[model samples]
Target: MESNENEFNPQQPNEHRPEQSAYGQPDQHVTNPSFKSKLELTIFSIEHLREIAKWSKFLAIIGFVGIGLNVLGLGFFFLLAPNMSPFAAEGLNIFAGFAGFIGFVFIMALYFLPILWLYRFGDNLKKAIDMNNSAELESAFGFLKKHYKYVGILIICFLVLYGLIIVFSMLGGLFAAMGTL
Candidate 1:
């Protein structure tokens, strides 16, 4: 018997794959493509999801607090930068304060979206489970996906940056060694 590559086969080892359930269960739709509804979650899965929602909400709240702290720190720095010994000089104070503020803002901006998505995911998931609304469940998963994708992109960017830093550091060392010889 010949098998079609496009068809999902549960028996096959990675030969074919199908979309998983939004709640992270093995979708039965893999075998029966015509199934329109998402697989229902078991009691065990619901408990697990509840725990996850609680944790996600906690972490997101912490992240928001951290951003708030960053804002306060930035304000405090500007207020005190002129008084700090090293940056007391007008020119040095302005430049250092501005640079620090810019860096802090950039970091905060980079982290804000992922945290927001996480918060929304947790909120939506909790509501969905309580009400048994499929639309809310789908929206919750969408937020989760966005949270992961945004973080994944950031990780990739940082990895490439680190690789470039390493390459450049090596090249600089090589040139320095040859210059001394």
Candidate 2:
């Protein structure tokens, strides 16, 4: 049988097809149906990201140092609790111990988590930039999100606590004035 050059041979396939995507092996045409190109805005420069990472690393170091100092201070306070001061009020030492415990659980632990997140953000940002890995870059931003979310929550809690304290103090002052009258 003579081979017809006009007709495509069963053995030969079209080689001009667009490259397939990594996710689904779908051709470029299937993925992007609209011929219009999508444009994305760059809000920050890579230099800015690098600068932020550097600052975050520095802050993380400082936070870890502060946490270490707080732990040491708490331990020292407990160790010296029994040494009675002539000026100390009744049960002051016990109250201090309780306060220290609360500080360890609330302040120290809370501070530590964000510090770790900041540390991770800095580390991931550096690695992502160096290796040009998109996943790592996303991970770095996620750490930042976690850090901010935690801090915001803590701020809100503290604001509410302060508000309550102010309200109680005002009521106490009013009661004290009434008692004096």
Candidate 3:
């Protein structure tokens, strides 16, 4: 039977290989594996981190714009209803105030969502970089998989906070009316 040259020869005496020292054994002088090449890993990690950074920057800009819109809406409300109290009357101004409040809350929540995404993306990016440095591919993917839940919780928390602020504002208005009466 003829063996192919491409096949490994386990039985061959590799005289070119150096003998190990007899203190049990010295460390083998095996050539580093191709997969351990620093250049390839560094390039891959840098590219991945660059992608994350780009997305984070984009989200940050969007969040800023959303926050600006919310502020503008608040300013508009104050300008239009400078002296009108919620308790004073029920009319178009009240409807406008309610609409403004809801719009502000929605805008605030929208701003918070992008911020949350940026944070979670940044966390995952750091984990990915660490994993790449340590050669822990599984852990890097695991961190990415868990990022969604963090974003979801952030949005939920923002909604709860917005609701609390609205409730407190209404309560303060009621109390102020009672104080004046």
Candidate 2, residue 125: CA error in Å? 0.6
Q: Rank the candidates by TM-score, best first.
A: 1, 2, 3
**Lowest-sum lDDT 10-residue window in model 2:** 8-17
Best candidate according to lDDT: 1
Count of backbone collisions in candidate 2:
0
- Model 1: per-residue Cα lDDT over 82-125, one tens digit each: 56635766567767776777788888989999999999999999
> Best candidate per TM-score, number?
1
Q: In angstroms, how far off is 168's CA in candidate 1?
A: 0.8
lDDT of 2: 0.72
Residue 37 shift from truth in candidate 3, angstroms: 18
lDDT of 2 at 139: 72
Encode model 2's per-residue lDDT on 1-181: one tens digit a residue: 8966544332322332233332324343643333443433254667787888899999999999998888777666654653453224665676666665576757788789989999999988988777766556767887888999999999999999999999999999999999998
State candidate 3's TM-score.
0.37
Model 1 reaches what TM-score against the true structure?
A: 0.74
* Residue 46, model 1, lDDT: 94
How many clashes in candidate 3? 0
In the range 1-181, model 3's lDDT, one tens digit per residue, is 9966434332322332223332224336764333332334467667867677567657667776778786776766644564564533554566666676777777577556546556555555665565543212323333444445656777799899999999999999999999999
